[model samples]
Target: MIRGEVYEYTIGNLRARIVVVSANPYNPQRATFAVILGADVPTPKSPSLVPLAAGDPTRGTIDMTRLRPLTRENLGARIGRLTRTTLVAVDDALRTYLGL
Candidate 1:
């Protein structure tokens, strides 16, 4: 079974979760690998241009044309990184367990 902690972080009004797991493969008594999941957030940067009309009435314009699109892309990248990291950790754990 996978065991880990879920860490939450807020970017602007968005909340994101990051799951971290320490896997024990070698001895079943020691943590052999670390797995990180979630932790998805848009990179800390602004887009090139702002949209003409965007944002909530109470929050004002959010620059939908640029920031919104870029935010999605950034989030995707973060998720991709999380997935890769988790896979690598799992692979390592399996390899260690099998003496590969």
Candidate 2:
């Protein structure tokens, strides 16, 4: 999957949604694993949470602090894609969180 695509991922007994944060070239088509961040709506406020697009039906905040590597096998179906603006916001949040 390409970057900014949302998918369902199961971690242990918890099934959660995640956003594909890895660049397209480093995703499943080329790499064994990809980077991702957990996604949720109406969560507690934090600097690590980047607000999503207001127009999206599935609008939610992406938890930048929950970043992790996901295996290709664990990557689930495509749930949604982030808007261009939202993706840019996420990129900025990532940079800030990582101190880049």
Candidate 3:
């Protein structure tokens, strides 16, 4: 999957929504694991959380603080993609959170 794509995955007994944050090329071709940020609702007030677009069906904040590497096999169906603006915001949050 490409960056900015959202997908569902089961972690233990909890099913969670995740957004792919890994860059392309490596993420699609080379990498065995892709980096993702869990999406959670009731958007909390945090500098690291990037809110999804208003029109998004899966409304939640991308928790930048908790970056998890998920294997391709673990990832489920494609939920939805982030809007251009939201993706940019996520990139900015990631930069700030990662100190990049």
Candidate 4:
């Protein structure tokens, strides 16, 4: 697995579009964590969505406010991928989230 790829993974009983925010994949024992998206429409740079595009729908919006820690047990099926541009924006958001 690679960073920036969006997937429809199931965490417990709920399923949502989550973006892989961690680095390095080969190891599948545990997932560092991910940003989860929901039916709630995200707004630009809000506590929820960062830079919401008027007509853009690529990956889960950069939700700096939330994340989920998953493992091989909770990791579910793959839904789709995110565009490179959006992924880059997400990377920026992540850096901001961590203040790194």
The number of the candidate with the highest TM-score is 3
- Candidate 1 residue lDDT tens string, 67-86: 11112221212221223443
Instruction: Report each candidate's C-alpha RMSD, comma-separated, in the order given.
Output: 16.3, 3.4, 3.1, 3.4
What lDDT score goes with residue 78 in model 4?
67
Using Cα atoms with residue i matched to residue i, what is each candidate's TM-score against the true structure?
0.20, 0.77, 0.81, 0.68
Against the true structure, candidate 1 reaches a TM-score of 0.20
**Residue pairs of candidate 4 with colliding backbone atoms:** 45-51
lDDT of 4 by residue, 1-100 (tens): 5665566666668776676667656336545556655546655545335543434344235576676665655566665556666657767777777777
lDDT at position 61, candidate 1 = 15
Q: Which 10 residues in a row give candidate 1 its minimum summed lDDT?
A: 50-59
* Candidate 3 residue runs with Cα over 4 Å from true position: 29-43
Which one wins on lDDT? 3
List the lowest-lDDT window of 10 residues for candidate 3: 31-40
State the lDDT of candidate 3 residue by residue for 1-100, as single tens digits: 7778888877877677887777877676543222344353355677788777776547767788878776676778888787888878878887888799
TM-score of candidate 3 relative to the true fold: 0.81
Candidate rank order under TM-score? 3, 2, 4, 1
Candidate 2 residue 74 Cα shift, in angstroms, is 2.1
The alpha-carbon lDDT assigned to residue 82 of candidate 2 equals: 81
